[model samples]
Target chain A: MLSIRDLVTSYGNIEALRGISLDAAEGEVTCLLGPNGAGKTTTLFTIAGILTAKSGAVVLNGEDMTRLRAAEVVSRGIALVPENRLVFPRMDVEDNLRAGAYSRRASAAEIAADVADMYRRFPRLEERKDQLAGTLSGGEQQMLAIARGLMARPRILLMDEPSIGLAPMIVAEIFDIIRELNREGVTILLVEQNARMALDVAHKFYLIEGGRITFSGSPGEIEQDEVIQRAYLGSRQG
Target chain B: MIDFIQNTVDGVMFGSSYALLAIGFTIVFGVMRRLNLAFGASIMLGAYMGTWLHVHYQVHVLVVAVTTVACTVLVGIYVERLCFHAVRRDAALASMVSSFVIWMQLEEAAIHLLPERTYAFPGLFAAGSYEAGPFLFRTEQTAMLLLAAVMVGALHLLLHRTRFGLALRATSENPLAAAYMGIHRTWTVLCAFVLMSLAGGVAGFAILATDQQITPFFGLWATFKGLIAMMLGGMGSLPGAILGGLLLGVVEAHALWYLGAEYRDLSAFLLLFAMLVSRPGGLLGQRILSREELAFRRV
Candidate 1:
């Protein structure tokens, strides 16, 4: 559903993503694995239009959407559940969901219905519908953030670090939710520092390091290569 | 005893207008983490429209106030567009002069229109004053107090109960994050500015109703009180602004009554200085920008 070619992004003097190119097929999970400062979030931000690209093209379903603003990109059916679960911290859970659905022109009744469906799926969110998002637990906040993104009604959902700093149980739960979401046919572009967990679920994976894509292949091929393993794991141990 | 009570009531009533102005001023500062100097002018513009409508159309006083408030909101939107929007990336104090320039322009226009003659606004409150010792309360003063309360309540309810209000509150805390949530950065800010300007306009009308005398400087007095209130209340906290205004008003009123009127402005300024020295974070303001928030935007 999404394709990128020669995408170069910079922040001031430093180059974040140096001439990177990748593609995600329709309705398939594409995971980007990287260590810190490896340009994982930068790629997502560039594609989501939060950061401007110095040069390159982001083609979504054959149409170039590289130049669109974040809000415009959302209207084109792209939503990013950003790093750090940057949920609208001060807004109520329900309002956060409403904010997610902001890009589309949904009627009040329709919005209510979508919100109800979201609440039904994520009951924790429904329970805390009126509470400030900032006060929610890290896991709950992450779930709320994802649920809020879903409210955007995007075709391709880009998630950055869905498992960072989360407990083992919560991380498992989040991955299960992602798997269920994918099974139900929502295309996902998940950026994970949790490489072992990412490799387990992702159909195809791309490894990024030092602002460049050094490898792109299936999980089996990536796990087989000693050099690829070193680049991904950073220590070929285990 | 009666004089003391009356003075306190007067102070509280006067404080209400100051509170509204302070709230408006602090709100923009809190959100963008920058002082919106043109804010005072935005209020004056609103006030001018309100009184102008009254002078021209012979509309009801309450209606005039509403019209004035609405006009200020438009001014707020315009100021946001022409002033704050462009200076976001420039020096922090780049827009400070924008307000002074607006103030001068407004002063010039008012002088031209009034034409070297002092003009008195029509007093809408039916006149009657209750007296006790050195303090007094006129029907107009009472009316001003009641109406100010109603305005504050309405403003508070709008902010707490509405979805747009929550978005606004969120914007005040973090504009960048608000944008990520699909809230239009410019629109949300414009909404806040409009609301603030409306408050300023209503304040002008309310003061005018009390026969407080409408010079070009009426706006300046209200703006000064607002700045003091912002310092007292901890910028951007709703309840805090009200308390600060009321406290400053009473302090000034007391000074006016006891220490003679010469001490009124000086007293208020000194009080604000004391408050600032004691609690630099402001009465309820936390996480405020220490240096200019706009300048901290090296990113």
Candidate 2:
């Protein structure tokens, strides 16, 4: 559903995304795996139109979204969960969810229904609906962030490092939520350092390094690659 | 005892105007995290414009008010476009300097428009006073108090109960995330200036009603008091701004009553200094901007 071609993004004099390109098909979990400072987040930001691209195009279902503003990008049906789950800390859970639907002109009834649907899916958030988001536990805050993104009712949801810093059990729960969301046919573009978890969920994977796509293949092919196993999976020998 | 009660009552009535001005000043700061030094100029312009319309054309009070508000809002948009928008991404100092230049220009406009240094604001109400036990009160003072309350209450409702309020708070908390959710950053900033400009109009009207005179210098005085009131309450705290304004008024009133008029401005500055030394963040402020954030590096 999304196509990026030869995208180049920079911050001042330093280029973070240098001619990187990738594709995320409709109804699939596409994962981008890379080490620190590998431009994984930069790629996602450029695609979301939060950062301007020096060169390249981001196409969503045949329409170019590269030059659109971030809010306009959301209107075109793309929602980003953002790095670090930057939920509105002072706003209540319900308010944050409401904020997600800001770009939509949906009826009040539809919004209420969607909010209700979110509460039903994440019962913990339902219980803490009135509490400030900052006061929630890390797991709960992560859930709120995802729910906030879903509130946009976008066809494509981009999540960055959804499992970083969560407990193992919580991480598993997050993965389950991702799977559940994908099953509902929401295309996901996931950025993660957890190669194992990403490999399990993603239908296609791209490994990026130094602002370039180093490798691209199906998870089956990636698991069998010796170099990737040693570098990303910590194998004993390549 | 009667004198003390009388001064306090007057102070409170006058404080409502200060509260309105400070609230407008602080809301813009809270949302933009930038100081709008030209806000005082806006207040001055509002007063001058309203008075000029009333005095020149014998316009109705309501008409004067509407015209003043509309004109001030447009001027605010103009100031944002001219002074604020370009420097927004640069640094706080850059915006402050730009706004200061605009402020001086606004004063110059006022001087040229009104050759006299001061213009008497035709009273909005008739010459009347009411007596409550030993206290005497002007009818306009009570009206000013009521108007301020209604305005603040309406503003509170707008911020808490509306979707626009949600978007505003979201933008204030994190502009990038707000943009991700489809809130237009530039529109939000513009809306903030609009809201503050409207507040400035109401405040200017109340101030003119109380003082019965409008001067080019009033803009600087209003800005100083508004800034002091905002800081005394806390930078980002709404209720804190209102309370701080009221407190400053009461403090100044008592200082003038006991120590003579010379201490009036001195007391306001002293209170500000005391707050800075004891609680640099103000009474209700959660956090002061760090050096980097204050410089607009982190925002």
Candidate 3:
């Protein structure tokens, strides 16, 4: 379980996350939905320790990790699959997976076993194990990014925009993967713009607007709200 | 024709030292994405440490060599802490200017220790030449070339076959993502500094021992040669560093033989200028990404 309490983070004078608080229970997909410039990505970054918070605390099951650096955050069992699927462009697929497990002290054999597991889950990666990650299709890159995060063997996986630019069919596939991961009991904190698909998989969802949480409910509750329907689902469902 | 071949042989032998120096620059630049202008000055100061020990205590050559490398690493750490680690990450220009300031400080420190224009450097081989067919090879230059090859090979293995290498390459490619993967950004940069300093110490020792002399100007000369060689081969590329150094050496050797000593440096600069004009990326530099790739990355 992860608890973020009144976290405030800023870039110079502009505050991206202004005292926003949220909770992600174990084995649940907690989704944060927001429009552009709504501080969704910033919240995830602060929790991952890539961006230092100006105040407040991030508690993982109890111990405070508010001041830990990014590496320390990963070692503490949080892995972030960053926005845009930022895989190492020049390294081969295998090497990229190896890099994902860098913070852990796993042996060569252990790591090889984990790599095999990843290849089994995503056979396309094994087929292109020797190819440069930069040349992979966008869908493949997204899969690699997810696999790379899983390589960390973290209890909490924070994925930012896993289906941003993929085709509709690919988006459905990604949502299926998310559901599969949640079923496997991997705690996920997802930031997404696709409210329909996100609601389909999210256990509990929160609506963030202008760096503040304005709504929180179950999928059924959100579907019945007129304002939520008009604001988020109107374009597609209409 | 024999003269040309002999000159090329000598050029390649001498170019080995430049290759070592350029490799140091490339490694540091590759990881940090910032230039350490004090690279040569730190090496010069380390070499000065060796010469001072030899001059004052009459120590063995092995001790002098070890002292040079150890001292260079120390000075290199100092530069990394003050000029790089202390500076903010986004302020790359500030770090460069800070390194330039440290270069001046190191130069003054070395001068204070020696207080002389030049001093004798202990040589590895006596005055002799080896005959291999028609070409003559100086004993010390051959030793220099062999040592350079060994060091480069060792460095290649270290980079391609280690966990540290994976972390380093990942950091170089994407610092933020590397962090997300749990790689320590500061520690990786610090280790790169140490690696570059070790190579630099060996290079300074090789060149000084071959020339059999040391001077204050060695700092400026080493920095310029290494920078030019790095730019020529391709910035942030290891193989490019080696090629650039060898090419610079061969060109300078021929120029010195044909057009007098004055044209040696002039010819080298001319070659650099032409290379920049024609291929700004250098011989093996990575080309700019395609527009489609760039657009995808942005999204």
The candidate that achieves the highest lDDT relative to the unseen native structure: 3
Candidate 3 residue A7 Cα shift, in angstroms, is: 2.3
Span of 10 residues, lowest total lDDT, candidate 2 chain A: A229-238
Which stretches of candidate 1 lie above 4 Å from their native place? A12-15, A167-169, A234-238, B1-4, B45-67, B115-117, B129-137, B160-163, B287-299
Show pairs that collide, candidate 3: none
Q: What is the C-alpha RMSD of each candidate to the true structure, in Å?
A: 4.4, 3.2, 2.8
Choose 1 or 2, whichever is better by lDDT.
Answer: 2
Residue range A1-238, candidate 2, lDDT tens digits? 8999999999999999889989999999999999999999999888888899999999999999999988889989999998888899888999999999998877878989999999999999999999999899888999999999999988899999999989989998999999998998989999999888888789999999999999999999998999899889886766
User: Residue-wise lDDT of candidate 3 within A1-238, one digit each (tens)?
Assistant: 8999998999999998888888999999999998999999999989998899999999999989999988899988999999999999989999999999998979989999999999998999999999999999999999999999999999899999999999999999989999998999999999999998998899888899988889988888889888899899874554
The DockQ figures for the candidates are 0.43, 0.85, 0.85
Which lDDT values do the candidates have, in the order given?
0.80, 0.88, 0.92
Q: Write the per-residue lDDT of candidate 2 for residues B1-299, one digit (tens) a residue.
A: 99999989888888887888788888888788888889889778766777788778988877777776777787888888887777657587888888999999999988877778787876668758999999899998888889899999999899887778888889888887888898987888888898888887888777777677889998899899889999999887789889888888888889999999999999999999999999989888877567878789645
lDDT digits (tens) for residues A40-90 of candidate 1: 999999999889899999999988989988878888889888778888776
Looking at candidate 1 chain B, the ten consecutive residues that score lowest on lDDT are: B111-120
Ranking the candidates on TM-score from highest down gives: 3, 2, 1
For each model, chain A TM-score? 0.95, 0.97, 0.97
